[model samples]
Target: MSESSDLVMPDAADSERAAEAALRPRHLEDFVGQPVVREQLSLVLEAAISRGNVPDHVLLSGPPGLGKTTLSMIIANEVGGSLRLTSGPAIQKPGDLAAVLSSLQEGDILFIDEIHRLARTAEEMLYLAMEDFRVDVMVGKGPGATSIPLPLPPFTVVGATTRAGLLPAPLRDRFGFTGHLEYYDDDELATIVVRNAVKLGADLTQDAANEIASRSRGTPRIANRLLRRVQDWAQVKGNGKLDLSAARAALDVFEVDQRGLDRLDRAVLEAVCVRFGGGPVGLTTLAVSVGEEPETVESVAEPYLVREGFLVRTPRGRAATALTWQHLGMAPPEQSDTLFT
Candidate 1:
């Protein structure tokens, strides 16, 4: 049996990584969903190109798998510039950041994923680089240390973060534009699944596409993953046809329910409802009850539950809504109203 962690987690496996790369949209026009963001970003890039100047710093904030990294690459493409991909965690110090910043060629787009997690010193260094296109490099050591100003070529910083709230205001304000990506609707995910099916050279029916999309938790990455799984099941168990039956059978084997709830998601709801009397329970306590890390529960499970109207996060604690009771086939207590109120 697969570990419980494998059920709903969105992390891509090694094999899936190559598939994702191949399915990625090369240009902004080919990208799926986020219409408002796409339009605004197009304007930003177009305006910059017309003026013959690098575009203003941009921040793309959204949940994982919603295509922030892809959009960053598109930004570079739209402006006809090269892209430098890095992550906040990889920059451990100011010097580390300086190396990347100083090496940027003119019109390059520096895409820093999880920008909110950047080290304080590196973040501070970025402020000057973003604003003035220069960095004060430290020379010598100790008391005799001198600062040398290094001029950087004009470039754009495209920052992507899942937690925009964690970024300091100064850092956040450095970006001239911030695009907040929301979860894709079922139709959008369906389109993404169909596109990926074509790319994978798999025969997928419309009903099967809808089935995978509806159970993808409003994520393109999950939709593609489910599509691949269904395709595999069709090849092995069926007559190599991706139809509704194949999709349903594959999802059932993977323990993904009709509403996209996996084992871990159900566990969270069960823990809150049955184990805690429908839970005005704290996140830490709830995570402990489910035998999962608090961060995992908070970041992964809770977002979808709350978005689906199955759970609510209050100042007090995490609580299951009435819909959660119905989904689990349970009756709410007589005092359940007061419990949430």
Candidate 2:
């Protein structure tokens, strides 16, 4: 699955990270989409800045490749706080979180990506710190352990998660403001593609930008990454012009379809339809058939497939829609008991 770099998930490679860093918007005004969240977040930051106090903890939830991390950085910038980046996996215990929290400089913003994955004990520790700016530290183990309450200066915690429902109610309730980010529309992604293309010094035409946007799977990170790929093709194969033709050729070379289905996505559909006879196949079976982790197939491939009407999820499992067969250029299978409405 990692071989399919265009699978709509954020790439963890250093090169991709460097590109994202270079192209990320530094200020709230420069953020490309999510108008409602932008407006509300701006108001919160403005009010907090005016009041000379740290803003309330912010919770941002969305799927990957959306702007949660970017928005968190914008929050830190707006609040005039240094951004401390970490992830839920990195904080394995209460002590791990304590080390991070105790080092805060009053106005610093600690951004926890994948916050929902935090250990329950660490989450319990966070509840007290977020609410009262204090943590009770244990000085010893067993019977000799002494609980020492430590007071902390006011700070902000910006927690970003792909699955908001997994967060505990106590931790979730502590966030004064929560913003849910949605996928970018084609027009918004088109604007972002064009803007980032210019930033990357590409001569991307408007139609080329639109083409990338349509195939970007409604994510700004995908749009920007595809623009970079198109730029590479333009430089190497298209006489240095990022025209519509170059963009189309590059996308075709990369095997991204008109509907943004990549090789993995199509493989999932092909397995369900051709192998399982338009399946109510279980997810593990589907992943095994397609040679992917269940998590990868579910998160990276299934969401867009389900969202775009190419696949359907049911109590039984996954089933292909009529469109999936047509997209695969195959005759529709006769309705079977496996099919669900």
For each candidate, what is the lDDT? Answer: 0.91, 0.91
Worst 10 residues of 1 by lDDT: 7-16
For candidate 2, give the lDDT: 0.91
Which ten-residue region of model 2 has the weakest summed lDDT? 332-341
Encode model 1's per-residue lDDT on 1-341: one tens digit a residue. Answer: 56866864545565667787888898989999999999999998889889999999999998999999889888888888999999999998999999898889999999999999999999989999999999999999999999999999999999999998999999999999999999999999999999999999999999999999999999988898899899889989999889999999999999999999999999999998888888789999999999999999998899999999999887889888888999999988777632444
lDDT, candidate 2, 1-341, per-residue tens: 67577555555576677888888888999998899999999999999999999998999998899999998888888878999999999999999999999999999999999999999999999999999999999998999999999999899999999999999999899999999999999999998888888888888899999999999999988888789899988888889999999999999999998999899999999999889998889999999999999999988999899998898898999998888888999876566644443
Query: Which residue pairs in model 2 clash with each other?
Result: none
lDDT, candidate 1, at 208: 95
Best by TM-score: 2
Candidate 2 residue-wise lDDT at 67? 93
Tell me how many clashing residue pairs each candidate has: 0, 0
